[model samples]
Target: MRLLLLAVIAALPAAAHADEAAERGEWLARQVCSNCHTISARAPAGRNPRSPPFSAIAARPDVTAGTIATYVRQPHANMPDHGLTARQAQDLAAFILAQKPR
Candidate 1:
């Protein structure tokens, strides 16, 4: 029981950190990616036609979270450079992956 309690306590901070990352990622996406891409179901009715929506990007079979993070670090020509830090890139990647369509 003591060990179990310790494990649960240890997990709490990690879970909170994960939630923080998700929130930060969402905020970053709204502030930046929302400019040129649809970030959510009810996002502003605007954005570059050429840019894939986050949901679409998330749904792509070939696109994984790691790849998305890498793209954030080194985007292709059509996508502008956001100059995001590594943490921000990971956060954005998390935000994008969270947008998978049903």
Candidate 2:
């Protein structure tokens, strides 16, 4: 029981940080990605039908935060380069991953 308690305490800070990152990512998505992608589950499809919703992306089995970050940093034919900093991309990835179906 003591070992378990110690482990849980050690993990709390990391879990809290992840939660914070997810929150920041959600805000950034609403401000920027909302124009093209549906950033939240309840949001209507974006004007660009070709752009996928964050939920769909999260649902994919192979999707990972690193992959999402890489995609966000690259220039795409349809997506305008937002020049998001590395930390922003990380936060966005965290937010998107949080949308994965439980």
RMSD of each: 2.6, 1.1
Residue 92 in candidate 1 has what lDDT?
Answer: 83
Clash counts for all predictions: 0, 0
Query: Taking the tens digit of each residue's C-alpha lDDT, what string does model 1 give over 1-102?
Result: 999999999999987876777779989988888888888887874369988889899999998878988888886788778898989988887778878887
lDDT of 1 at 30: 84
TM-score list, all predictions:
0.79, 0.94
Measured with C-alpha atoms, the lDDT of residue 25 in candidate 2 is 96
TM-score of candidate 1 against the unseen true structure? 0.79
Please state the error at residue 71 of candidate 1 in Å. Answer: 0.4
Model 2 regions more than 4 Å off: none
Task: Supply candidate 1's per-residue lDDT for 72.
Answer: 82
Candidate 1 segments exceeding 4 Å error: 1-15
